[model samples]
Target: MIWRVATLSFLLTLSYLCFQPVKMEDGKEESMELGTQSQSQMDTSDSQNKGSNEVEEKNPSVEKSGEMKPDKTESDSGSKPTNNEKSANKTPEENMVEEKKSEKTVELKFPTTLEGFGYKFDEDGKLGDIETGEPFVFKVRSHDDSYNQKRYEALGEVITEYVYELLEKEANLKRVHIPVDASEGEAQSFIFMTEDALTNPDKLLLLIHGSGVVRAGQWARRLIINDNLKSGTQLPFIKRAVDSGYGVIVFNTNENRIRQGDKFIPVRESSTAVDHGLYVWEEFVSKSAARNIAIVAHSYGGVVTVELAIEKEAEFKERVFAIALTDSVHSLSHQEVSSSVIKLFKRIAKNWVSSKEPLDTPVPSRHRYECPQVSAGTNKHEETSWSSFESIFEMLDKAYKEVTEIDKEEL
Candidate 1:
């Protein structure tokens, strides 16, 4: 009778343990709807729950400290936990926030140098295409001219340094700094020349650029920013001058300011455009022992050449065999060119003015008696130098040969 009672109690305890309710971590009991939920439905529900947990771990808020937040149930929003909360607790608002954070993290990095800027150049050095790093600030027109000028100057500074490096390395030019002012010994202007420039070769070619932010080895910074390096810079000109057995000197006429200690100050002797030209000519050009000289002047450089001629008339006429001016801004009355200088200009100089006509085609006269005008092929002012490059070289070569022949005959 005792054995039968013990067996019956043990069986009742086993049945109670098997049929007990499933208690969750939250202390709430969950009952499975076995009849309504199939095997596929149960599997799908588990997968959705696992996906929510993975998203919470992997997709942390980038805007925040990039840390994962603790899991929150429907109870956090002042609502009772539902059966569906087990699959996914994220609201529509939470999903949208995560999407926005991911979008905000994506950014494009702009390049610092021209080589890394992803621009393509053609054989003639024209800009074929741009893949990246085009600053949009330049495209938008501003009402303020001064503001635009400042921006362009800043951009030109970077390009100027790059061109200076190219001049030293690629063109094999030496940079020489000359003190312009006795008071400010540290503040000086610089020029680039061949090794034989000071030694005075048989033939010398002097390149002078326009006014503005253009430096020694640059024709136009605008073209460099918008076009290609070849069209904008003076590397091609320097190379041609070297290959033709002529010593080259490129003037940094526009670089009038030098950084002294803590502040930027104007070079004493080269404070103005004309003054700079005068100082360089007296210090370098006049001092050189070159037999025959040639000048290639562009824009305000034409003004400088005229000033040099006026100041040193006898020397200019005797030494300078050729003068090629591209869109020269020289004024006979404004710059006070003398009758003697006018005669010299007519004898050896030719102005390649920007025009729609073909290259070397005669254009209308500008003054009573300045150098004769010919079409530069391009109507653009900035492109005049590069467009007339070939014609100018041909004129220089012909003049050089003729002058040398005349000297030989005299001897």
Candidate 2:
């Protein structure tokens, strides 16, 4: 009887050892059955979550052990979702944008945020609408084309004026009036000045608007007319320049000639773009104790820049640090861009051109001899400035640092 009891006890010990849970590193005693159950529950939870957008839905199996699974939905497959699924993913802002885009008229609200580009997009990566302060996007639904054109033109002018006024109101900007040719008769050349810029500035950034109806603090006239302030105006650039410790100069080259005495004459203080640019450099830029000068010019402003550089080669060589031009119309053919000028440009200028390649990516340029031409990372002619702003400024900062370092080393 003693031997039988011992055999029975030994058999019981072996059975307990065989069924014991493996000891975990944390000294937790989990039964093998419990671990198997937990794993089964996890697998079930994952299966239940497959392509299901419902987050709070609890699995029935999870209530007992933690999991559930259902038939694979359309979202489970790695293939494109159906139109109905796309509609289901639409965000509130995206829906609003779609509704707004379809309407010929919308109540526009001025943008108050700088976190984003102010573009509304859907969950599926579709651009919905843009926020521009214009009250309506003019469209001629009726047959009166002439009347429609007139209506839009007047509205566009109003918006342009409104944006310019807004720029004038920015705290960092100061309005500096330059005298045009005394021959232009009482006309004044205006450039926006940032705070602390009237005196000697260590860094000066010149902002030149494109040609035509555009004025100071503007990149393109149609950006305001067709798009919004974000696209049309240079406020973003101005804000950035000011933040980056640069004295901002919004060059109003196109606003040189005015009608003061009946006949169109250059304002008493005004000159044409070419002459006005030169005059500004001589009077304000050259005189400013700016140790380093950089220029950001768009469109025809390139002509003004190159002409100024060629005219004031000595000043340019001595002070101008970098030049960033967007969709510049100035070509080397216009002025052979002499070897000396080309060398200076190669050392300092970066021409932002509209190309399919990514921003700042170098592209083959017919005028590479003039300067470094690269993709502004956008195909839109007007958008080149904004798209390349961060990248271009980064380059400028790097170059500036190098120059400063070299100066320090020389000392």
Candidate 3:
């Protein structure tokens, strides 16, 4: 009977142990289900909070929950967050803020039209109507007899009209008028040159206008006519240079008025003026195939032209055959002349040093002068003088003759 009782006790204990394991397994499954439900609730709460924040940013101060008190009162009350209350919590707006700081900076490249590069000319490479072949003309003159305020105003009106007409008529050449301060005065100018003039030898001739003549619409018109005629009196120097197998282009310097002392007008440095001219020249060059260039500048343009030559001498020397300056105020420097002596000796020392070497070893020399090649002329009157147009013409003619002679000798 004792043995049987002991066996029964052992079986009972073993059966209880087995049943305990099943009960523990069922409890673990229930715990896992509770954890999963908790996680799902948290995820749904986060989504709802994000949506609420977005709405608050748009509307500001809209209640998200019916039971919630005012934000300021809830902050002061120090209430503990319940499980449901925790679900409504919103992330700080500062954390949600999109910084929007650009990590990749974009560089802008300007647009270039076929006409923008100076390609507006025809087979002859002239600035005329493409359909009719008739050269564009302008009435570029002062408003009245005097070079006073009224005269300048009238001049400005004419210029405006001419520019409008040119843009309206020419589909090939695009013109942009960069305006300075209108309140100060009428400071505006335009650029006109064939896009292919720099690269195409058939289209060579970069024309840069000097101070007063730059704004005169007649200057560009005359230049165009001269270019078309190829033997006209308007730009005889340009025609001569072109005939000698050189390309031409033109730029308008910043200073447009002829008045001697205008405080309002800004005085540009020689370097700045030259750079502006060159900037336009390079634009034409980038689009064309012609390499050889001859720059023809008049008066103040002379200074601008020389600056460009000096600045781009190494590059231009191989390509630019010659530069013609007409009645220019600026002086030229010799290759041998040092910067220290340039101010005192001017062109004389520079010329002497350049010519000194070639004199002793000449084999039937073609160039007659021993000096650095420069053709300069001056009218007897002061810069402010309104002299006879004939005297100006004579000075220009003599200067042209000297330049051609130099070119012939050098070539």
Candidate 4:
């Protein structure tokens, strides 16, 4: 019975030992699977960290490249710019600068400001005060006949007397008269200075006379006709101009004998009255010390005035702010005048052919028609004429009023 019990105990112990070993083996296998899973998770975490670090390092480079790119855009396929994208991308300042540059390149070249008249470069490529060089020397030429000579001399005397009276009567003007000789059968050019006239450098009056009329006599005589010289005359125009301060100078283109002819006569091309007038203007009036001047031309005087204005367009553009034409012959368009009357005059005046006929005359058309083709090259005067002198004065008042209005606006 003791032997049987010991064997049974040994058997049970052996079985227990075997069961324990199997349980230990199962635990080892579970632990091994858990360790492998942890190792795989750690490897995956490290790979993700490295990828994030690389993206952070490259971010600034991508941003800099985007800023440095030219004005362009990529399409859905990343090949070309899309229209909608282009519209949204550009800045307003860039667009404005481009538009301004285009306008400046295409704009017409014309005078736009006051400074442009004085300082702007001309087609000749010369600057201000460079072309004239020095003051011009005036020379007198005679075309006077015996009858016209006496008439001119008497006219001069009448004018000189009237001016002397004006100097005495008008307290504003300090007048000095310097007489030149007309004994050579030529019309005389008188130089007069007024202290009051010279006081205003900004404003100047250039009084130019028409054909068959001497400037020296006609200028003052017209004042008499207008009653500006008489005590009863209001003289408001003169007073206002003087009060405003202006320099006044008169030029006599018709003082020459060629201009005083009783009838139209064709003459040598060079000896034409127009040629002489142009010569006188270029040499005398254009180079005068009075830099700023406004022309007031009467009758055929418009011819001479227009010629000078056109010839010196670049020089006198600003200075010659206005041209007042009174009873001017060249103011009317040739088309406006009767062609029959023109034909009749041509036939009648044809008999008086001489060596001194003006190039502008004896033609089928009026003086204005010939003006464009003359040595003057272009016409610059604004035409103002009426059927009568009364109408002319009315227009003059209107013109003066308009000028005053413009001055006010500028101020």
What is the number of backbone collisions in each predicted candidate, taken in the order shown?
0, 13, 18, 8
Residue 2 miss distance in model 3 (angstroms):
99
Judge candidate 4 against the unseen true structure and give its global Cα lDDT, from 0 to 1: 0.35
Sort order, TM-score high to low? 1, 2, 3, 4
Q: What would the per-residue lDDT of candidate 1 be over residues 1-411, giving only the tens digit for each residue?
A: 465334323432332232233444433223332221111111000100100011111222233323334356545565565434532467766755664565456542333454443334445555332553333133121222232334334444656787899899989999988663465366777889999886756888999987655788887765665566787788989999989988889988777888878888887667665677788778888888888999998877887788788778888888999999987766655455678888888889998876778899998774678788898887655677888889999999999999999999999
Worst 10-residue lDDT window, candidate 1: 43-52
Model 4 TM-score is 0.34
Model 1, residue 152: distance off in Å is 5.1
**lDDT over C-alpha atoms for residue 306 of model 1:** 84
Worst 10 residues of 4 by lDDT: 43-52
lDDT (C-alpha, whole model) for all candidates? 0.67, 0.61, 0.35, 0.35
Model 3: residues with Cα > 4 Å off, grouped in runs? 1-149, 156-190, 198-203, 216-247, 255-272, 333-411
Taking the tens digit of each residue's C-alpha lDDT, what string does model 4 give over 1-411? Answer: 465334434432332222121112212111111111111111000000000011111222122212343345554667565544443476766644544454345522332331332222233322222243221111111211222223323433444444445444653443332122224444333333345344554666655544432333243232232122331111233454455455655444433433436643222221323454455445545555554455555445554554454455455554555555432334223223244333322221111111122322231223433322111111111111111223323433454556668778999
lDDT of 3 at 157: 38
lDDT of 4 at 405: 80
Show where candidate 1 strays beyond 4 Å.
1-137, 140-153, 180-185
Model 3 misses residue 272 by how many Å?
Answer: 4.6
